[model samples]
Target chain A: MTNTENAPSGAEIRLEEVTKRYSGTASPAVASVTMTIPPGKTVIFVGPSGCGKTTTMKMINRLIEPTSGRISIDDRDVLDIDPDKLRRTIGYAIQQAGLFPHMTVAQNIGMVPSLLRWNKKKLAERVEEMLDLVGLDSAVFHDRYPRQLSGGQQQRVGVARALAADPPVLLMDEPFGAVDPITRGNLQDELMRLQSELHKTIVFVTHDFDEAVKLGDRIAVLGEQSKILQYDTPEAILQNPADDTVAGFVGAGASLKQLTLLRVRDVELKQEAITARPDETVEAVRRQLEERNRPFALVLDERDRPARWVHKRQLAQASSLRTAGKPIGDFVSTQSTLQDALEACLAEGGAAVVTKERGRYAGTIDIDTVMATVQRLRDEAGVSE
Target chain B: MNQFFEFVGQRWGSLLFDLYQHGSLVLQCTVLAVVIGVGIGIAVYSSPGGSAIATALTSAILTIPSFALFGLFIPVLGLGVQPAVITLTLYALLPIVRNTIVGLANIDPAVTGAARGIGMHRLGVLTRIELRLAWPSILAGTRVSVQMLMGIAAIAAFAKGPGLGGSIFSGLAAIGSKTAVDRALAGTIGIVVLALVVDGLLVLLGRFTTSPGVRARA
Candidate 1:
């Protein structure tokens, strides 16, 4: 079957004046903060420790019920349903993976599905699919226990287990907080790829602002006692933070960080660069490149995708463009972030080739334009340094 | 020694009967004590006040000498297997109850939190997650209770309770007789054998029932 055909859409979650008060604490752990989490989007709650960011996220799933406030999902009140039954329909993954040590990886992933009363055969197949989705091989890992797995692998199994039942709303509380930085980056990228496909309403909580910028479509920067300091898209937060705390939280390199929020397709591609078919004569391509006053001619293959970069100097040694110059060193897709494009330009030594659908030749993106975008962001934000 | 061997050979049938009776008494009481202890443990383990009370109550019962406990039971329950069973079972409660509290308390909060977060009902968490993880510690408690009851059961003969305790008590009563030492020796040896055998079985039970993931690794 097709992937997106069965992709699960999420339910919108609304919180109205939710507050959690612990007795004798003299103050509510989470203040009377309210916000709506749109369906099929990743919203992050980011703040320093003891900021109650996690408490706000948990209130939606009712793991820690709100002391006062009305919480609803898709217009139905959450307090109306039983917490256990509601939890069954909400995916949850936590730090250290929170995997049960007694159960094997297969059994762990199969936990939620089996609880939802899926039949034996379907549950087994779903567990396998989940393991595969999390990049774990079932044949090797299925019968293995959690202790047998590495930290990152256990975290993958944790995600697989939470997703086994395919709940529409997924709540992740610092799921990658326990891993080393290198593995954490890889896990974050993997989650981004997964979210692009799953499109589940995800509420992710993290203390790290960089992680929030990378993963969240909208970020909720909370202050002490769970006060909502700012709520906006990652771009808005990066370019124009609502307050000094948020700006400080976004930290230095806010403009460079904004580059990650913009994709290659969002920027204008340079079409003045000359291009020639691989079947063309090297002299003809050189003449076109010289006439255009461009330093190089991009050679395209039959499908019109970039195949080689023929410099006027490199083209002189070759007779045919097909056999001419060096192979295309680096290219960025329209979907690739500008930071990615910047990296590609560095690898290519000048212009980075950009492609659209089916890797068809789009145009070129250079380092200067990316720097200009950063400066433009700085100017718009009214900040100079 | 020659006289003791000859005396043992002569009364082998009765000795075997006493041994069987002794083993049965300890086994049944141990099981009954475990059920009661675990039930109390599950009930009170979550609250410090309740755990302390149950543990203190059971430990107080343990402080009463087995003979004195049997004597005290005679006034209320009035003798025979009833007094023996109740007293031994009550005595068995301390280790099992204490261990149960410790076992239930020692579970990782993350594991229980995960269990609850994933939609397991409270009872489901208790029976499936809590009980399963706590099994090894509970079973260790059960083992301690069983070993203890083996020696204590000999005192059960004070109430005419079944077992090798009957032979040992009678032999003690006839202390000046030539066969007194042999008779007492037979009963004492029978209990020691039974304790070792039952403990071995419990170890086997642990191996077969415990998840290897949780079992202690060398």
Candidate 2:
């Protein structure tokens, strides 16, 4: 087992003019798609059905042989390795889950480990760990058969089984597509959380662009017959769509799609902040800051230069205490992403204060920042009319 | 009424008495024939592309004049039950072999893929998945073969084997109404009962063991 500790920055997945043609076909199913996927990042393949997204994924593990071109994993050529060995090293998940009907959940998850001839104790431990990793209770599900499980439960088991050996690379073909929308969201969230922790190089194939945008670190927007339209982050693709096909896929609400992708830097944050004098009564400050929902109330020195941050928490606490006089200064930045800004405001009981250099008072971000971020991201994403 | 009572009281009385006398011989022959026929069926069915060859061979065996085939067997294996049992057994193979091939071939490819993907090797897959799924069709074929065996066992008595057919053959030689009609009727009725019983048993077995999916579709 090679330690990926110094694993060369990002996972370098390279395809040099890769193409696949079935025995009878005149044209390649996947035409010379040469792309590189950065390590520990998700690269999504998006296109219509039969456009060879699936074929391209399978070629990575040699489930389907590529007619031409070389594929390199890390730095080694993959064609020289045995197919089964290569597949075992690469975790594979499919749309149907494809669990064996007769096997128990534990045995199913333990398949690759057992194939690798792992010790009984080690295999058993791995199975339990995987079941827990997929948010399934190992005790409840270990002994149950596949037939006893529901579609969503079975899909979790499928993920568990693929990840049983803890392979560094994962290839998923619409893994959550079979589940209901609500369950799909839950699974996607779970997968995202897992990816953050494990950092496995992932190649995901899906026909759903929304799912692609939701999950992909970088998406390869593919056109008919496996043409690479654009390979970019969801933000970049939304902001500067390559063509009508790509724009159409981002949909009529491309602006809304941008909100999903755009970070806090793309939205404006107030830099200058108004301050209340330190000697001012808490009541006076309350009257100034209450219901207005500013990110912070700044405490000023005698000259009214930047002093400290008076977060909304101090005001709310002061109101409860009925204290006459107090200085307020403790808050987070307004420049954080809407997610962080919203969290900070909520943390300070509906309004967070910001601090600039050396704890100097700065403006805050509230729900208004969130709305502005959404609107700006939408505009920048190219919403016509 | 007096004549009927006298007939009942006599040592060799009704058709039932005649059937009872020779039933063991036919039962023995049927059992041995089934075992031999099933073995041949398995062997031939498992052979690659042996279906057509086996079917033609069985068809030819059925066509050989039954009494004449018995006579030919007697010259080689001597008289008595051996020749009769072997001939009847050979006749039972066609249906069983044909059905076995059909059963094994008809399993779902998707199910097979699922089995293989889970790392079940060849024999494990065959026994646990394919063979179990194909069992009902295979049993149906065996039922047809067993029913045919019951009807053919009576003809085996011609070669001095003690079957119900012996009584019929004896009656034919005698050419007299009194014993001939009684003997011939006894053999015919026994064969019908045997066929009915075997077919009924197989039907019950099929119901008990067939998969719910297969049973519903069937």
Candidate 3:
């Protein structure tokens, strides 16, 4: 991952003392912002409305010229390059897709490549390839105009158009802000999948903290005048906000949101629970539970999968382990999110059974373990509860 | 009516010639007006002050009575096609210029921004994106101009310009003479019939030229 500094697919962007002062304005629009965006990472700029988050992202591609600052990409000064030529090399996508109404989907996607004077045959191939990459069927969508498509479909075309030329850097300004929540989630997932393979240096701007956490590899929480409150991984930001403003932006369910970021596999499972075959006599299970000094024991079936939970008191009414205690109601796999684990743990009202491949009894995650895991994350982030 | 029909049959050759000239005059003037109007629109659409001035000037020309316009042009330019072309083209400019300005101004800035974001230069955005999207409005303006010009070109004949207006004026001058009413009715009917045909052709042109995405809305 350290070699990502010179990743072939994307180029690093650096902004140094970038400030934009609109004439007659008392304060600069973006006042002295400096940050280095690593190559091949989706770095998000999240902030409240009119906080200059969008203005910062736009400056990267020179859409809004920085009044006085040096901005460089891959160590080459962006201001040195011709603005239009530089823009052609940087992919840009915005909300509502902004596709040309007169052009078909293929035309919109092919515009930049065609501008670069790619030959007709190659340009045509690239358009089809781009459409396919964005999960659009060329046969159906290639000839269709932007208005003919649905909102989500239009956004897909917008993304496809931006990526058509395979620019090393992509600047997205709230690209998913206009879509319905459900479609927006699907689009975010699709973008994540695309980024995994493409690895373009993406500078995304959004006011939605949840969206930033969901999509960004590193989220830069911006404040007034494009101030960088916290520029770190989502995990770090959620667990430990930089200050009161950032914490307020993170909102009340910060730890709850943190749970969604973690998975069951990442945490230690409680594997020392006493277990017995369901066919064994309930007297032996009760004796084993007493020997282990535990209030309950898990009963495993023939193939060693979890079958039931036998309480110390329930063993008196049952003659055999087969008829002992109560059936295991719900369980989570090792791949489940900690949030899902917590839900399952709460539903079962005790230690939640953790399963591995094919529902085999793996271990357990009790309520205390779930609480402690979140506490451990907070501790690691140097943030107190 | 029977006398008008008999007169048309007798003067069919001359009437057809008048119709052709009337059509030619309207077509030429409309094309000229569109060229100038769209140019002014493109130049001024981005500037509120310029657009307002251009629109006001074109509209002022429209308020001038047609006969008075002909009289004003006659002293400097005299009669015939020169006055007719200038007068007719001037009168047609209001709709074309206004529509062009409105159409160009109405284009979504986001669309133009996206165009520039994708590497289109200033002229590229103007010709390829802004103009194309605003074309529907521009074309509608042209349609209105053409309709207005069809009637206005008849007035141009008062300055001794070519077209059916000459015949209508002659019929009025020769009132109570045999076939005078027939001649006047012939000129009136010919202009109406020819205006419809030209408008239909313009409609067909719109169908062919306009993008389906825009056409769907219209």
- Where does candidate 3 stray beyond 4 Å? A1-8, A268-336, A344-369, A383-385
Q: Cα miss at A304, model 2 (Å)?
A: 31
Query: Which portions of model 2 show Cα errors greater than 4 Å?
Result: A1-12, A262-367, A371-385, B1-218
What is each predicted model's overall lDDT from 0 to 1? 0.89, 0.72, 0.90
Cα lDDT tens digits, model 1, B142-211, are 9999999999999999898999998899999999998998999989998998899989999999999888
Report the lDDT tens digits of candidate 3 across residue range B14-82. Answer: 999999999999999999999999999999999999999999999999999998999899999988899
Q: TM-scores for chain B, in order?
A: 0.97, 0.80, 0.97
Pick the DockQ winner: 3
Q: Rank the candidates by lDDT, best first.
A: 3, 1, 2
| TM-score for candidate 2, residues paired by index | 0.63
Q: Per-residue lDDT for A113-163 in model 3, tens only?
A: 998999999999999999888899988998998888999999999999899
In candidate 1, what are the lDDT values of residues A1-385, reduced to their tens digit? Answer: 1225667678899999999999899989999989999998999999999999999988888889899999999898999999999999999999999888778899889988888899999998998899889898878999998888899998899898888898889999999999999999889988998998899899999999999999999999999999999999898898788899999999998877888888998889999778888777777877887777877788888998999887788877887887877898889999998988999999998679999999999999999889888878778667532
Interface RMSD of 3: 0.7
Give the CA lDDT, 0 to 100, for residue A52 in model 3. 97
* TM-score (2 decimals) of chain A in model 1: 0.87
